[model samples]
Every structure is written in structure tokens, then in C-alpha cells.
Target chain A: MKGVVFVKLSEFVEETWGLALWDELLQEADLASDGIYTTVCVYDDQEFFSLVSLIGNKKGITVAQAQKAFGEWIFTELYAIAPPGAHDFVDIFEFLHGVQNVIHVEVKKLNPDGLLPEFDFLFESEKTLRFHYKSPRKLCYFCEGLIYGLSKHVNQEVTVSHVECEHNNDDRCVLEVSKVG
Target chain B: MDKNPPPEALDIQLLKRKIEREQKARQIAEQQLEVHSREIYQTNLSLKKSLDYAKKKNAEIEYLTKASYDVSSELTLFDILQSTVALTGRFFNAAHGINAIFDGQKVQPNSKPLIWSSGGFWDQNIELQSFFFKHFPLERAGAPPEWLIMPIDENDRIEGQSFRWIVCINFELGNDSSVWIGFLSKSELIDEEALNVLEIAKGHLRSGIRRRLSDARTVRRNIELQETATHLEDARKQLIQSERMASLGELAAGVAHEINNPIGYIRANLQVLDDYLKEFKSTFKLIEEKVNLTGSLSKQEFTDTANKQDLNFLLEDAESILKSNLEGVERVKEIVEGLKSFSHAGDDNLKQISIYECVGTALRVVANEFKYQHQIINELEKTLPNILSNYGQLQQVFVNLLINSAHSMPDGGTLKIYSELSGKNLLIHVEDTGVGMDEQTKNQIFNPFFTTKPVGKGTGLGLSVTYAILEAQHISIVVDSTLGKGTCFTLGFTVD
Candidate 1:
């Protein structure tokens, strides 16, 4: 009941990284859903999940590849939102380790500007969770969007976004997400 | 027969051989004798030559030694001069020599130098006199003999000039022996080269003259410095003593004021006591008189009671005793008030103070000394304005004068103090009819340490200190006195 869910990757990326590239990526991957569908990302030390269940028609890749792809996408999203001038993967890892809860993905057709999301996933912990994303240019933008989306969805603005690991491969992704507000 | 025949031929051969050997030995002996004779001849020739050369060298050394001894022997200026003339005359074979010394004033020829020479050429040669005068200028010349006159200097000024010349009959001796030397008459010529020898003999004359002049100035300066130091020391001592006396005066004033406060009350109390005692005695006396008049008593009983009490005499004596005690208390109070006023007189700053106030304060302070002894009469002008002065110092001046006046009067006398304003000056006069001072004593009265009082009774600095203080403030004091009659001191100061 408390797992993360993404109804649409476009809405999720728009709210997290503050970019519309996620809509293009979702259309290319053909992963769009109306009902709630859950996407889960598991790593060696930590795990994350998103559930999307279709209300009308579901168009996307297989669930396994979607999960993997979501993992890579989330990794890229974490890198985009990471702080500027962060060189060491460990520093990014520690930053992501802090936000263990309070992260969510949602899709909403009524909000044209994507100003509001349906669901928000938040990581909650005493320590900060840090990670690196593939798109280094969009790290700070993504982190700022994530914080704004989390503050708007939870009505609690005291959430922190962090990077968990180095994003060395475009296909393989790593992230540790948490919530602090 | 054959041997006899040949004898003559054999004899001839033997003779020839013998003769040849003998001739050879004789030739060798003759050559050895010739060598010995030549060696003896050579030795005699060398010995004779060495002896002649040694004799010649010994004579030359003796002459040189004699010349050196003769030249260095003359040390003093006179001796050097005399010997130079004598040696030159002897060397050049001249007849006479004359030496003249020139000073800036005159040229004096040495008499003994000319007298010693044989010829009287000095008297004959007018050219010599003119030559000497022309060459040896009176201002700058000295002992002369070598055609160059050397000036003798003491402290870098030419003091004397000596001229030396030879009177010669002929010029063969090259003008050496005819030299004559003379020195100036006014200044003594010292031998410069023989300073060590001549200095011992003339030490007293030169140094004595120099010291006499310098010592006089040194002695006068030393005396003046000593006198100044002594005066300064005396002033220092007097200043210290005056400060002490001022402090003592203040202490006495404070004590007097403190005593006056109590004595003032005590005197009042005693007056009341006296009055009450008088009233009690009078009442008691009246009762006794009334009792005696009204009551009847036995004669012996009345006599006994009268003898025991003596009420009439007791009443009479009580009034006198109370009166005397009250008078004594009043006297104590008066003395206290006088001391207080004298001590507190000059607490205020300097201003134009009335001379009368100065006199009053001084008299009050010394009132005990003058109370029953001398009568002070004040003839101060009522219209006289106050004079500008430090009030305390003025009071001190007045006190000194008053005390001096009282001291002069062993018995009782009159002291008249008066002041008047003349032009811009205030004249204060203290005249006393006491034992006056003679001229000698009065002359030295203002000198420190000159006192008539017995030793330890007076420091003798009071009048001199007062004189100094007054003089420093531009005030003058004049004294008029006649022995056995009176003395008056007038103090004058410029008014503001």
C-alpha cells in the first residue's frame, strides 16, 4: 500500500527533472498507461518501486524491461536533479541515501502545465540518500523539480533530494531515493 | 917504481874533484843568506809605514773631538752669545766684535761684549750701526751672527732681537771669529736650544710674575662665589625656619580657637556663678543681721555662735573671691581670642589690605609679650587707603617689628605705630622709646649671625630675613636711632 507508483513517465519526469524530454522518452518506449501500474527498481544495496494501473488502455514495453528502463530513467532523473559541482560518486551516494522515502510518480491529464501530480513517492530516513544520473546537465534541474513536486504533493516542503551512485552506463542505472522535506 | 911516477898525475885528479865539491857547497850557503836579508828588509819597511799612518789619524781624531766639545759647551743665552763672539773673533782673527740687541722700543748694545774685544771698532764704525739697525728691525729680529737674524718668541710674539757682527781687520778668516752678540734691554732673551739648562735657573722669576697677576683675579672670583653661596645658604635656612614658624603659628591659632570656645562659655558660666554667690551671701548676711536684732540670747551663747560662724566676714570675702575668679576667666578668653585672630589673619589671598589690620593682627599675636610691659599707641590715619601686598607676609613683617620693639624695652615703654599715604607709597612707622642701638650695632643689625642676644636665645636672622623679603617685594626699610633715647623703623611700599 505504501509502494511508489507511476501512471505516466512523462508526468513523473516533468515534475521531477522539470523537463519535457520524459514525454518523448515515454512515447519512444511506448510505456503509457491510464490505470495504475507499478514500476520497481532493485539494486545491490537498496530497492525502489512504482505501480501504474491502467484505467482505459495501457501501451508500454514488457514489465521487466519497463522496470529496467525505469531504473535507467530514474538514475538519469537523479543525476539531473543532483547538486552542482558534485564530483565524487560517494558524495552523490550519501546525498541520495538521505531521502529514503517520499518519492512518487503520477500522471494527470487535467493539469496541462503538469502543475499537480496524483501521487508522490518519498523516501524517509535519518541519513541522506545520494545518486548520480546519466544526464549530468539536468541534475540540478531534476532535483529542484523533484523537491517542488514533493512539496506540492505532500503539502510538506521539508523534503531533500540526493544522488546515490555513479551513473557510468546508460543502460544500467543506480539510485537511492529518500524524503526529508 | 911505476906508482911513484904516476903520483903527480893522481894528485892533480884528486884536487880537481875536491875543488868542485867545495864550490858547490859554498854556492848553496850564499843563496840562503841572501833570502834572510831580503825578509828582514821588507819587515822594517812595513813597520815604519804603519807607525806614521797611526800618528796622523790620532791627531785628526783629537782635533775633531776638541771642536765638538767647544761648540756644545755654551748653553745659556748669555754664554752662547758671548762664546759665539769670542769664537768668531778667535777663528777669523778679527780685532774686536760688538753685538746689539733690538726691542720694539730701543736697540741696546751689550757693554760687556764690546769691552771684551780688543779693538774699539764699535765706536769707530758708523756703517756698522746703520747696518745693524737696517737689517735687525726693532719689531722683528733676534740673535744674529750668520747674516740671518733669528727672532726670539714667547707665546708667539717677538720679544727681543739680538744682533751679532764681527769687527775684522781683514777678510781672510771668512767672518767667523769677529762675531758679537747682544740682546734687548727690556725683554730677557732665553736660549731656546738650552731650555732645560736655563729653565731651572729662571723658573721663579718667570712663573712668579705670571702667577701674581692671575692669582689676584682667581682670588677675587673665589671670594665672590663663596659669599654668594653663603648668602644662598642663609636664605635657604631662613625660608625653612619661617615655614616652620608659620606652621607653629597656625597650630597655636587652632589651639587658641579651640580653647576660646570653651573659655567663652566658661567665662559666662563663672559670671552667673559669681552673681548667684553674691546673692546667696547677701541673703545670708541679711538673715544673720535680722536674727541678731530680733532674737534674745545669752551673752556667752551668742558669742560662741558668732565665733563659730563668722557670717559677716564670710559674706564680705565671698564677693571678692567670685569677682577675682570671673576676672581670671575673662583674661584667659581674651588671650585665646588674640591668638586665634593672629593665627587666622592671613588666610585670605593677597589684596590691598589696611595697614591698621596688619598692625592689629601683629599686636594681637604678640600681645602677651607687650601686655603689661609696653603701651602701644596707634596713630594710623583714618583716610589712608589699603596697600597692595601678600597679607600673610605683611603680617609677618609687622610681627617681627613689634617683637623687636618689645624686646628693646626691658622695663616699660611706649610703642607708637602709625601709617600714612604719601603720593603712591604707604609709609609705616614703628617708633619705640627703648634702649636704642649705637651706630656700630645699627650698621650690622641687618647682617646675618650678628646678634646682641645671648647664644641660643636668638638666631639673629630675623631682621635680615625681613629685609630680604621686603626688598624682594620692592619695599624699603629705613631706621632712625639715637643711643640711649629711642629707635624708629619706617617701612615703605608702593600702593596699588
Candidate 2:
């Protein structure tokens, strides 16, 4: 995991729940990073899971819900610093396609060793898009939330369905998204 | 203060942490820029190398194109050698050139090479020859390769031009000579690219020399063939003339026979007349003696001698003999005149000669040939217009035809000669009912060296000469023949 993810997640938690709750979650997390993350450095992924678990325990939510909330926050935060190409795509599907294709390629160049999930896409139709994903982290809920967050940014209504998830019997996750009528 | 810090103290601590995090992010951003800058520099370096290689290759291609065009355009070997050396020097920045041409194995002759400096043509040809003789003698003839590069000989630099290395390319010139075109470089070694460019020029020069030499040989061969044809033509003309002489000889023999018959009877008649005159003279002489001059006998003696001589019968027979002798003399005169006209070999000027007269003269020339073996049929029109033609040549044409007709009738077949006036033309036909030729033989009868007669009996140039004479007169001949029946030769002489 890249330190940027941790830095953005911490920023999201502090902004949504205030600095006192973020300080409390950091204290309880017992992280290797000690809740100090910089965007250029790498950190242990387990420490990231611990931080999210701490946030979930303190906020009276499951770890999946905490992770989903962090994913949504980071999507908007990342778009605020999006490249010129990302802003050119007006539709949610176009934006999501650009993120995986254009943005991810550029991002990979910057952080080649970052533990990013690999995605294979099928634009089943103009109205539907499916993302086949595989990762050791198995962050299916986080990717689903990222799709919902992109739809929010474009003000487009889309239904994100987990056709298959690593958490279930499936070996890899397939998220099928459809535009709302 | 309470157990937790007050708002001012907590806000100061939070402000300090925010500043520290901002400083750290700036440091990381600067490090990323350095790594990206190194990668960008590497990519630019790779692109530069590729562009340089492409440019070098393009130069080599352009050089080869120009070099080949320059070499191949020259037709002569000397011009090709000079042009190739000049192109090589200009291409590789060479300062001077030297070319030598001589024979190697006759299959290829090297271009006689005199070292040509950048200044002008080499005037010292003898000196250059001596230099090559002293160094690369004829004994070095092992049939060298197409190209060679050697260090400039320190022993001999005739003009002393400070030439570094010499690149010599050679190809065949002619059977008697070889050619060498050498480019003299300056100080520096030529690079691989320039060497590759020279290889292309070598290929063009090799084939150019070969093609130009082959072309020269072809031109020479054409001239030789033309000369041979001219000699053959001269020989054929001479043979046709000999054939004409042979015809004249035959005519002479025939006229001799005709003249001898008339002369023989004329001489006998004269001898009889001489004896009768002598008797009369003796009787007269006896009377003259009594009257005047000698007075050797009496008048009565003269009367007795005259009475004994039988004067009336002698006088009458003498008149008949004298008349016969006069007719015989006229016949001999006519035969001699005919021989004179037929034997006029130089009478070649075109004139309006009567076709009937020409045929008559020809028949008379060969009259003896026809007398014993063949029957003659002459139905020629005397009123036919005279043709504008050489009299002697036409005479030769008609005589050859009449003789050939007579010869064909070996076992006494009919010989028929006639004339007809077609539109603007007079057609003379000579027919024979002898051994006639087939279509193949008929077609070839007029060709030189074509003969149906026995080898010693015929020169085979008779009809060929006839055809040549007719063609010169712008007259056409057509022969119609059947194997068993007869043959007719029609000469169509256009009347002017």
C-alpha cells in the first residue's frame, strides 16, 4: 500500500469525525507507521487494516463499512488533484474508464511498487460496465464504493452490483455496474 | 486548566503537526522529479542514436544511387574508368586518382592506367608505362579480383601528391586489354559506411565495362560480316561475267558452223568460176595476141581454141556460180554481224531496243544449239514497242533464256519463243518441252549457284545473271513449269 492511501484516509477521517476521534483511533490502532504517513513513502498493509479496524470499532461500524467510507472519501480527494484528462470525461462510466486506463497508468509510473489492484474491464453495453478485479487485499467493498463515489462526482445515478466477490466462493471479484434509468 | 488541555494549547499542537506534514510532502515531490528527469534523459539519448544511424544509412543509399548512375552512363571503357575513379574520389573525399589499362588474359583487358592527379591530364604516358612495368610486370598476371585496397607505394609517387591509400577496382575491357580504376585517398582511413558505398559503385562499373565491351565487339562483328558480304557479292558478279563469256563462246561456235557452211560452198563455186574464166581468158588471150599486146598466136588459132573450150556451157554455169557465191557472201556477212552484236559485252547503256529484235538475235546466237536437238517456234510480234533497256544485257538475258530452253530439251523437244504486249509492258516468253522442273526447283532456278544442268556443262549463274539484268532493267520474270509437260519463262519488260 502507498502512503498516499493512508494519508488520504486519515485526512478523510479527521475531516468527517474531527481531530479528536482520529487521534483516539490512532492511539488504539498501534500502527507501525504510528499514524504518520507521507504520500511518497510505502507502509505496511496490515497497519492500514488495523487503523481501519480501530476506526470501525470506535465509530460503532463494521470494518467493511469503515473501509467503504474511506474509499468514497479518497475518490473525491483524489479527483480534486485529478489530471486534466480525468476532468474531461463527463460521464461516470467514462470517468471510471479513465481512472482505470489513463489515471492508473500515470499513477503506476509514479508508484510502480505500490500494491494496487489489477482490473480487467468489459463494457458489456453503453449502459453497463463490468470490472474484473484481483488483489491479495481482496478490497471488493472498497472498489464498489469507489464506483459509487465516481457516480456522485459526475452527478450520474449508477447501480454497482457485486456479480462475484473474493470474499465469497469466487476466486476473483467481478463488479457489474449499470446506469440507473 | 482542566484535565485535557484547553483549546488554545490543542490548536497550537495541531498547527505544528500540519506544518510538519506539509514540509514532508514537498520533500517527497522533489525526489520524484529527480527520478523522472533521469528516465527522460535516457530516452532522449536512445532516440538520438537511432536518428544518427538512420541519417548515416540514408547518406550511404544516396551515395550509391549517384555512383551507379554515373558509372553506368558511360559507353566507352576509358570514360567509365575515369568517371568511376572521379566519383569514388568525390564520394570518399579522395584527392587524386590513377587508372591503368592493359590486357590480362584477353577475356578482360585492364584499363590502361596513368595516374591522374587533381590538377589535369597526365602528360607523361611513357613515364607512367615504365613505372608500371618496373613495379607490376606482366608476370604478375594471376587474374586478379574485381577490387583491391593497398597501401600507397612509397617507392614510386610520380607526381608526389601525398596520396595515402589506393582503392583499385577493375573489370574486363576487351579481349586484348584490362582496366583498373584506383581512387587515391588523402590521410584519413575511410569509414565502413563509405566502404559499403564503394561496393555498389564496383558492381555498376563491372557490368558497365562488360556491356560496353560486348557492344563494341558486336559493332566490330557487324562490320566484318558486312565486308564478307561485299566480297561474296564481288565474287558472284565476276562469276556471272564469266558465265556471260561462256555464252559468247557458245555463240562464237554456233556462228562458226553457220558461216563455215556458206563459206565452204562459196569457195567451191568460186573455184569453178576461176577454171571457166581461165579457159575464156586463154581464148581471149589468143585473139589479143593476134590483135595487140603479145601477138603470140594467129587469129585462126584463137578461133580453133575458143571452139574447143565449149564457151556457151562454161559461160552459163559461170553465171550460176557467181550468183550463188554472192548469196553465200551475204550470209557470212550476216552471221559475222550477229556474232559482233552478241559479243559486245560492254554495250550496257539503256536504250529503246526492240523486244522482237532482241529475241531474234538471241535465237540466232543459239541457232546451232537448237538445230540438231530441238524444233523452233517463233511467233514474236515485230510491232511490239521497244523497251527502254540495256541492249547487250537484254541480249544476254534473251540468249541465256533461249540457250536454257534449248538445253532443257535434251532429247529434241520443241523450243518456242514469243512476245506479247501487255498494258505498258512487253512480255517475252521462251518455252521448252523438255525436262520440266517441279515447284521447288522452279522457285530456286533464278538463285545463284542453282543448276539443273550437269556441273561441268552449266555455270548455274546463267539465269541468276538473267534475273539480275532483268531486275536492273526494272523488268520482272515469271516462270511457269510442269514436271512432265513443259516450262515457260515470261519476261515482262515495262515499255517507256
Candidate 3:
């Protein structure tokens, strides 16, 4: 896991629950860095799962729901961290489309060894965009949260749905996002 | 203790449930962590791909920049085309690439293309060449634009292989000049970046080809000008020679007529003198006979008188002297006559006459010139019909040809003259058994002032004049000759 994601999660937990819960979860997880994280360094992904699960249990929510919420929170955080020029996206469709060709490519430039999910834009129309998502991490719900987060960031009204889900034994997850009038 | 133990029992059961819950939570967290770890690994793989693609695109841009510079700087069109083909192959990862220019002359579908390809495959494939020529427009109206894309037919393929993608970029240089760059792949579809590279390369190709065409035109124009100048100089020389020949002919005709009068008197006077000599000899014989009968003097006295006069020798040699003189005068007359016939000008009357008669007259005119050295054999067909033509000019032409034949054989040889009636024409052949001319000589044999004879011996105008006269009469002449074998001059005259 990227240290940035971990940092964001820690911030999210500290803001939602409390700073003491964040500290206690880190200690319980027994991370390699002993609860210290930076935006640039890499960390074990297990620590992230442990922390999120603990947070989920404390809040009486499912693990998937916690992951989805974290995904939405990270989206807004990425938008804030992005350069001002990144705000030029016209709508959620534009922002989501850029994820594969533009955003992920830039990410690779920033971190030469960084990993990113594969996104293939299947089709596009005036009010709709569809893509196939393939990743080893079965995070289809997280991708769905990103689409909704894109809509929120662009201040646009849109509906995003999954026509195919890898969790349901599909080869890949297929997202169909449509713009609202 | 069995019925209602302390509250500690209920608390201990709740604690066990709590511990089980914690264990279940840890298992789920571990599974999710595994998924997240896989996701990171996949994302890294994707990142590597992105970097490679970026590197490929960067290399493409660098090559394109270099190609642009090379195209503009290359001195020749061939170099530019070669570079373009090489770069295009690299850009598209093409299996086959060709850069071609349409040479101006022929562009038939089967015509050889002016192409440069990376491999020898295109040169070996005739069907591919045909396909290219059939599709490419060698000539167009208002000129084809700088760039065009030619689509390949889905059903069309090459070299027993199917190509799903083939892109042809035609870069037109003005004035029906253009270059075509083609990239072909069997499986890989050309992407947007490749198309972009092609578009950029076209401008360079166009300018390079344009410069080449301009240079070619300039060189061609220079050659044309040089050729025109040479032709004009030749025409001037021919005109001067023609005028000089015309003036010489007029002078010759006047001299011939003036000489004809004296030749006539000299020939008549020689005949009279020969007759008088014959009379004198007979009178002497009669006197001798009378003297013998009368026996007026002794035999010694008569013999002495005869010896003193040298009468026997005089009688024998004097006749031959007069005959030789007559022959000389006759030769002079014939020469004057030949000169007059050759110089004869003006459109004379057309007379319906047998060609045999003309050949006979020509033979008589040139007989003394060749009779002693060559035998003249005539194979004229008596059944041949007469033709309406200028008798005098035809006789002159024949006379000149016979004289030429005579001159060809300084030693004894046969001069064969024959005629045959072909379809609507009379074909006359004058063949000689003499040393014939070579190819070069035969080619220039009828050119004015061109001759193989020595400077003083020949005017070099005989055959040329003959050619002019025959041409004026609408007759065609052909010469077939082999060195050391013979020459045959065939003349065709339309018979009406």
C-alpha cells in the first residue's frame, strides 16, 4: 500500500473516531514502522486491513462498507492534493476517463515502481461512459465509490453502476456512468 | 451452584463470545489485506507498461525530428525517399515499407515502380507492384494535395499473407510529381501515434521531392536548349550548301550548252577529214595500178618513190588516228550532254513512255564512262506498261545511278538494271557487283555533300541530287548493301 493511502486513512480515522483510537489501532496492528507513516514510503497492506477492520468493528459496519467509505474519503483527499490544473475536468465522465490514460500515467511518473489498476474505456457517448476494470484486488465497490466521489468533486449530478462484477465470478468489473440533466 | 451460580458465569460466557468475534475479524482483515497486496502489485505492473509506452513515444518524437532535418538537408530525392521509408517502418513496426516516386513517363498497372523498400520482398512481388500502380494516381487535375491516405481493400492481400492494416501516404509535389510511403503489417493495427508520425513526415517528403523535380526540370530545359541550338546550326549549314549547289548547277548548265556547239562542229569536221583520207588512199591505189600496166618506169624507180613518201605506214596509221579523234570528240559531246541533263531545271512536260526506253537512253548516255570497265546487263520486262512522268528527269536520275554504279567498280564488274511491276507501282532495281558500303556509309549515302569518293574525284552531290529528283517525283528509294558483297538500289514509282 502507498504510504499516502495509509496516511489518508489514519487522518480519516482520527477525524471520525478520535486520535486515541487511531493510536490504539496502530499499536494493536503492530506495524513495522511502529505507527509512524509518511506520504512517500511504502508499507505493508496488512496493517491497513487491520486498522480498517478495527474501525469497522468499532462502528458496527461491514468491512466492504468501511472500504467503500475510505475510498470516497481518499478521492476528495486526492483532489485536494492534486495540482490546480487537475481541476479543469468538465464533469465526472471527464475525471473518470482520465483515471486510466492520464491520472495513472502521471502516477507512474511520480513513482516508477508504483502499481495501478488497468482501466479500458469500452465506449463513450454524449451522456455516458463505460469501462472495464481489471485488478487483482477485488475492489469493485471501491471503484464505484471513486465514480461517485468524482461526481462530488466535479459538483455534477451523475449515476454510476456496475454491469459486471469480478466478485460475482465475472472476468472483470464493468462500470457504466451516465450524466444527469 | 447448578441452578443459579454467581453473575460471574454469565459474564464469562459473554467474554468467550467477544474473543471469538475478535478472531473472526482478524481472519477477514487478513483476507482483505491479501487482496490489497495483489492490487498494489498489479498497479506496479501497469505503471511499468505506462513508462514503456512513454519511452516508445519519446523515441518516436526524437526520430521524427531527425527525419525532418534529414529530409530538408538531403541533396537528392532518392536519399529522402530512402530515409522516409526506413523511418516509417520503424515508426509503425511495419512488416513491409515502401517509398516510391512516380517517374513522369509511364504508369501502367504493370509498369515497374520507382520504389525503395527496406527488404527485397517488394521488388520480388509483381502483384504488389500492380496493386500500387492501380491505386496510385500518377496524374491528376489541379494537382493532388500534399498528403493523402489510400485505403487497402479488405479482400486484397500480398505474398500469400493477409494484412489487416495498410496505410499509404501520398505526398504530392506539384506538376504531377509525388512520393508515396506505404506501411504494411499483417496483424498490428496502426495506432493514432503512427498516424500522427505519418502526417508529420509528409511535409518533409513533399518539400524534398519538390526540390528534386525542380532540379530535374532545370537540367532538362538546359538540354533542350542545347539541342535546339545544334539543330539550328545544322539547318544553316544545309541551307548554305543548297544555295551553293543551285548556283553551281546554273553555271554548269550554261557551260554545257556553250560547249555543245563546238563539240558538234568538231565531230562533223572529223568525219569529213576521215572521208577525204579514204578518197586519197583509193586514188593512190589506182595510180599505182595504172603505173604497173603502162610500165612507164622501171620497178626500182616506183619503189624508191613509195619508200620516200612512207605511203604504206601512212595509209595504215592515218585511219586509226582519225577514228581515235572522232571517239575523243564523241566522248566530249556525251559529257556535255550528261552535264546538260543533270542540270536540267524547270518542270518539264510529262510524257507517257516505257521505262525500258528511259533505261536505254540512260545506258547510252553513260556508256563510254563504264563500258570498258563494266558490263551493263538490262533485265527490263518488255510487257511492263508505260508511265506518265517527266522523261528527261527520269533519264537524268537513271544516268546518275548508272554512273555511280560504274564508279563503284573501277575494275570490271556487272551493273545489273531490272524492273518489276508491283501493286500500283513500278519497282526498278539497279544492283552492282562492287565493293559495297558499311552501315555508317549507307546511312549517310543520301545526305547532301556526304560521299566516300576522294575530294577532287567526286562532287558528293550525285546521290543527293538523285534523291531530290526521285523524291520530287514521289518515288521511294531503298538501299541494301553488304560490305565486299554488293549494293542494290531499289526505286519505287507509282504507276497511274
Candidate 4:
């Protein structure tokens, strides 16, 4: 069956882990699909473990053990299903390509309408992004939907893949995506 | 062999299709995540911006509250205005500010609003306008900037019945605009409060002005009252002096007449005695010559000489001198008695007194006043009847007239006092041949305080008091005087 999976985390545990854990986790992990593991760890700490047990009534582990398990899982299970730009190297390349297309098509469409489009998005790894578009309404409509879809997926707390687009203003076909966990 | 290769190629195609589907799903999730991250970042930025703005707003409110508190602290009108202008200037960052108050008629911009601000900033020629307008050329003109023109209104109405006021506030450094505050009522500017500071100030100004005006009026009225009181006091003193003089004049006149009668009889008697003494001396001389011729004469001859000399006649002449001196003494006594009666008449009842007797009594009292100055000529009619009157006051009136007559005759002259019996009335006249009064003097002669004599000599109240006395007794006195000739004062009384 094809379906989406969702998980609600404790807000307190998420805040306690903060942005520092995300940065360190992203830097050290080797995210590649080798089919050697099954589960991935997002945040780990003694406080987070206790907080999770209180909220979910699950077993707990120390931060050091969870960090080692998260690194091993990223290289195997999480990478297995991730798209082409799931890792940093592919994600940066896809994002630059997507930004160029968005800027060109939206600016061309918005020049006649005298409106600037603004938007916000979130990744599955709890990373936020913002943008202001000096763009036209027709192009901004698609960008707005795409950014909204990305924020919805991030709310589900899952990993994502990155991709680039081939279409410009003349063509309505474009492919742009980035991975976050 | 061909069938086995076909199945393997089909399996590879299915796997490629599945991988494409999974990659597309992953791309969708990544886009959603990026969008959510951007939204959170934008929300955080907006929240920070709003918090900063609120902090600044609170600071501005605090500053305004402190400024208003300081402005209301002053109590006096001038101080309040000054502080209001100063605080408003500081708040708006203006250079110079001025408050001009109105007088009733016109706006005196240059004049200091109070006596205390004598040396303060005062500017004239400030005018009221609908709005503060900058003088700009038509080419550069557009919709002008808005100016703050707050009018100080007393009764919530502003228009024709408004006070004249003009306030000019200069711009601060690097600014070119100014704010103007004015009032519709002069009184509305008091106490520096929003409700009616100007009105209270105007009220104070009006009260101050009114107080000054009333003070001046009171001072003028007091001066007038004092002058009137002094005049009244002087009149009273003169009245008293005149009455005393009149009594003195009456006494002098009466004594003069009495002494004249006695002196006249004594002179007559002395002349007769002188003649008798001359005759006796001649007879004695003859006897002496006869005795010398016949040396030893007989006693019979001496007896003949004594009989010839008439010794009884000499004794009779000596008795006559003694009798005449006694008569002179009696005449003096009569004069004294008449004076005493006239003076004491004030204690007696108002009765029907003979007109002749009244005249004589008055003459006796004023005998000394007219002693040598004038000769009194009485032309009293024998048929003159008595009149019902206050004897003392009537005597005083008579005496005043007679004395006035004597005074008129500075040099010796004849004073004629006469009476005529008319129907039910007796008209008595006292006339003097002396320097008479002119028309002007005569008109005011009976007016109290009107005097023709030198100061300190005559109090001029004599005739006036005399007129009053006679009038009180229901009698009338009329005077007729010819300048450089003589005067006649006529008294008319009703007979019982």
C-alpha cells in the first residue's frame, strides 16, 4: 500500500535538542543508501530521552549511544529511500538550479503586475527558510503551492530528497526539490 | 533462449519505473520542508520587529506624560502661558514661541501681558490667520502642508465675538515650520489647563483693571467729600463769630446812647454854674471897693451887701448841680438796665413786645458799637403797635441791623431808625448815611459765609443770621442800598 507516515514529537524535547544537534548530526553523518540498517535517530540526549519516555512511554537511551545509532542509520535506512538531493552534495546542486529557475520565471511574470511575492518553507529536519519574490502572479502560484507542500511534509517529521528543474518561463514543466531530515 | 531474455528485460523496466516514483515523492517532501522553514523564519522576524516598535511607543507616551505634568505646575497666568509655550516648544522642537493677549479694544502684541514681564520677549504686529501659510511662488505651490493651529476658546464658540490674539512659534534648528496657538476669549488663557486657562487669565486681567479704576474713583470721591466738609466747618465758625459780633455791636450802641444822654445834662448844668460864679465874683469886687473907701463900716452895711449878693440863689444853683449829677447817674443806670434786659430776653417768653421798645432795647445794646461813628436819629411813630414775636431773637435781629448800619458808616454819619404802622403790620427801617453796598455785595449779603470786610474783621454771617432769626419769628427783613450813598434795612412784623 502507498501511504504517508506521521509522528508527533514532544515540543519540549525538540526545543531542548535545539539547532546545535541538527548541525552536528548533519555534519558527521554519511547519508548513503547501502541497505545495512533500518532505523534512524533525529535527536538524542539524556534529557530528551526522559522527555520522550514521559510523553510516549517508550524506553530511553543516553545521547552518545543514540548519536552513534543515528549515524549508522543515516548511511543505510534513511538514505535508501531518499531522492537524488537527499545528501548535502546533491541538495546544494539541486537548490541552486531551482533558485535560478524560480527567480527567472517569477520575475518575468511579476514585472507587469507590480507585485512582490513572499513565502516561507520548512524541511523535515526542522530547518526553516524564507524568501521574497519580485515576481508575477502566474509563476508565484506554482511556487506558492510547491513551498506549501514542502512545509506540509516537514510537519510530518520525515526525511526528504532534493531535485532540480528543466523548465523556464516559456515552458510550464519544472522539477525542484531538496531533502531534509 | 529467446524467451528467457525477454523476461529479464521486463523485470529491469519495472524496477526503473518504481525508482522514478520514489524520487518524485522525496522531492515533494523536501520542497514542503523548505517552505515550512521559511515561514518560521518570517514569523520570528515579524515578532521581533513588532516588539521593538511597541517599546518605542511606550517611551513616547512616558515623555508626553512628563511634559504635561510639568506644564500644569505653574499657578500664575503669565507663568502658565510662559511655561506652556516653552514646554510645547521643547516637545515639538521649536526655536521661539510667543503668547499675545488682547486688550478690550485691540491686540497689544508687543506689550507685556503682565507687569512682571516688563523686560521679556514682546513682539508687535502679529496677526491672526486661518492657517499658517508659507509665502511660496505659484509655480512651486501644491497642496500645502498641514499646520497646527489650536485656538484657545472660552465658551466653545469661535467667530466674530472672539478676542484678538496671535501666537508665533519659530522652527527649531534645520526646521522651517512653526505652530501657532491662540484664544477666542481674552479670559480663556488662565491656569494653563485644557478646559479654561485662558478664560481665568482674562478674568484676572479684567479684575486688576477694574480695581485700579475703582480705586481712582474712590480717591476722587473722598477728596470731594473732604472739601465739602471743610466748607461746612468754616461756615459754622463764621456763624458763631457773626452772632458774637452782633451782640457786641448791640451792647456798644446801647451804652453809647446812654452815656450821651448823661453827658449832655452834665454839660448844661456846668454852663449855668459858670454864669452864677461870674455874677458872685463881680458883687464881691464891689463890696471890697466900698470897704476900702469907708475904713470902719458898721454890721448893718455887711448885712445889706450879703442880701444884695443873693446867697439863697447860689445855694439853689449848687442844689441844681447836685440834682443834675444824680439825674446823670440815673440815666447811666437806665442804660445798664436796658442792656441787662435785652441780654436776658433770650430766657423770656415770646410775647407781644412794643415795636418802639424793641428798637430802643436794640439801640441800647449796640450803643458802644456806634458811639462816635454815627448819630442815631429815631423817627419812631407814637401809634406803632406791639408785635407778637420772640423778644430775644427780635432784639438780636434789630441789633444786627443797627450795628451793620454803624459799620457801613466808617466816617461819622447820621443813622435814622424809624417805624411805620401799616395794616396789621409794623414796618421798621434802620438807615445809615455811610458807604453803601453795591448790587453784587447786596445780593450775597444774606448768604452765609459771604463777607465784604477784610478777613478776621467781619465774619459776614451777621446779616445772614439776622435774616434767619427774623424769618424764624415769622418776620421779614428787606435791604436797599445805593453805592457810595447809604443803606436801609427794613423789618416787617405782624401785629397781634
Q: Please report, in order, the local distance difference test score of every candidate based on alpha carbons.
A: 0.50, 0.75, 0.70, 0.52
lDDT score of residue A19 within candidate 3: 60
DockQ of 2: 0.12
lDDT of 1 by residue, B401-487 (tens): 777787788798999988767788888899999899999999999886677877755557667767766776678899999887889
Order the candidate numbers by TM-score, best to worst: 2, 3, 4, 1
lDDT of 2 at B297: 69
- lDDT per residue (tens digit) for residues B351-407 in model 3: 687888777767755665564568878999667788877776777678667767877
Regions of candidate 2 where Cα sits further than 4 Å from its true position? A1-181, B1-76, B79-93, B104-113, B125-145, B153-160, B174-176, B191-200, B241-255, B272-357, B372-397, B407-414, B421-426, B433-476, B482-485, B494-496
RMSD of 3: 26.6
What is the iRMSD of the candidate numbered 1?
A: 84.7
Docking class of 2: incorrect
Cα TM-score per model: 0.30, 0.50, 0.38, 0.32
TM-score of every candidate's chain A: 0.23, 0.91, 0.87, 0.20
Shift in Å, residue B206, candidate 2: 3.1
Q: How large is the C-alpha RMSD of every model relative to the true structure?
A: 46.3, 13.9, 26.6, 30.4
Winner by lDDT: 2
lDDT of 3 by residue, A47-117 (tens): 77778888788789987678878887778888787644566777677777667667777777777787678
Residue B334 in candidate 1, Cα distance off native in Å: 6.2
Q: State the local distance difference test value for candidate 1.
A: 0.50
Cα interface RMSD of each candidate? 84.7, 2.8, 10.1, 13.2
lDDT of 2: 0.75
Question: TM-score: which is higher, 3 or 4?
Answer: 3
Candidate with best TM-score: 2
Q: Measured by C-alpha RMSD in angstroms, how accurate is candidate 2?
A: 13.9
Q: Using TM-score as the measure, name the better of candidate 2 and candidate 3.
A: 2
